[model samples]
Target: MQVGGKSQTTWQPLGWTGASGGGRVGERRWRLVDVAASAGISTQQVRNYLADGLLPPAGRTPSGYRMFTERHVRALAVARRMAEGHGWARTREVLAAVHRGELPAALAALDAGHAELDRERAEIARVLGAFETVLDSPAAAVPRRDARIGVVAAQVGVRTSQLRLWEQRGLLRPHRQRGTGYRVYDVAEWRAAQVVALLRRGGYPFDIITAVLDELRSTGRPDRVRAELARREQDLHARSLRRLRGSAALSDYLAETVPAGTH
Candidate 1:
């Protein structure tokens, strides 16, 4: 990347002519195979990137062979790093900005993505802190076995429809009384309801909650909370690292390309 308005480095494209190599002996073009090898990625992966419009199209020789350059290699490296960091959709945004010659917009997109990650990590930490506070608080007295849906819903501070939706998603299953057919929540169900409520408040996805609940039911593990939160922390840390590397690559690309465009 550039420093103090001066371009730091530029990569020059080179041509090789060898009959045993990817292209014809007299050809000086960089072949697709050569580009893939240089980039340390699969040929199919490069093609997939081209299909995704992440990489610009290659120049074509008279025989219709794809020809790449050092610039293409640099672009591919940046795209790969972005994919590793920000995922497909976010990567596409940054790539599109760069493609349109919007370097600042690309940097802004990276900033936004990382900011979202920071918010999510902070939310997870707050949830964990709240959960610990809940554990330390004295337990409320047990309710009657015939506790109705409305009562449970009020206690959990969620709407009745939300509780029903959770049940519809197979997350909760309160018993239906025989005569009135009203939903009934027992002690065990109340505990499950509390767990679901806390998790939902923490913005956990349905599938993750379902999986954790299933594991809890099958294994009776008391360490599920610690295990799940620990895994989430590790995942966020890894993502942060990816974002850092991706930003570096994008900055380098912008630095090398911007000065050339100015001239």
Candidate 2:
């Protein structure tokens, strides 16, 4: 990042190899405006990053002005990537730890985020499996065309109170019959209820069952439901890759900045 005319005030490599064993490199002192322009953020935001410990402390000039350097710029770049991948809260943790020269703590925070992603992936797999288990179960028909609460309870083999509880838990949203004020279940609601019943029978908790019902309601077809879950799986994979990239960048930065035999 350079400090000059508009054309010069953009991002250019301040010379980071993104590789290990290059300790305390890049001696160029950057300007605040140049750093802000290069990162496409405001000067105030850069200051906020400093205040929030998202970046290492900037050096100070003899005149008491903040001294921006190539190291600060590289750290900002890494923080941006980590924020995208590990999320802001964990990003703050990693950045703060790294600035403190506690590389192990920074790595530990990243590992924790990856562990969370793993748990989410596993939960999605379980939900998909549960969906398959209850896919073949028949939805009990309403006696008449009315698809009211008791009718659905009888057909789904659930108590009326249980249905009401599901409604309370936001698992169901049946419409009310005008003037009679009774809950009315439409064809789609009947389908959702069927899903809830089978998952409940399989002993899944409300949260996991919620995932299956959400996909089923939104997609309205078995193939579409499967596709949506697959898309979620792909998203998890993408996030995992992003986190890996962030971790690599941080490792490279630490190796370059920390003096030999100090870390």
Task: Give me candidate 1's TM-score against the actual structure.
Answer: 0.65
Question: Which has the greatest TM-score?
Answer: 2
lDDT, candidate 2, 58-94, per-residue tens: 7666777777777789889988988888888999998
Q: What are the per-model C-alpha RMSD values against the true structure?
A: 8.4, 10.0
Per-candidate clashes, comma-separated? 0, 0
lDDT of each: 0.71, 0.79
**Per-model TM against the reference:** 0.65, 0.76
lDDT of 1 at 194: 72
Q: What is the lDDT of residue 4 in candidate 1?
A: 94
Off by over 4 Å in 2: 1-26, 37-44, 101-105, 138-144, 257-263
Instruction: State the local distance difference test value for candidate 2.
Output: 0.79
Lowest summed lDDT over 10 consecutive residues: which window, candidate 1? 11-20
| lDDT score for residue 131 of model 1 | 54
Q: State the lDDT of candidate 1 residue by residue for 144-224, as single tens digits.
A: 665888988888879999889889998887999999899998876776677778777777767656755665565455467
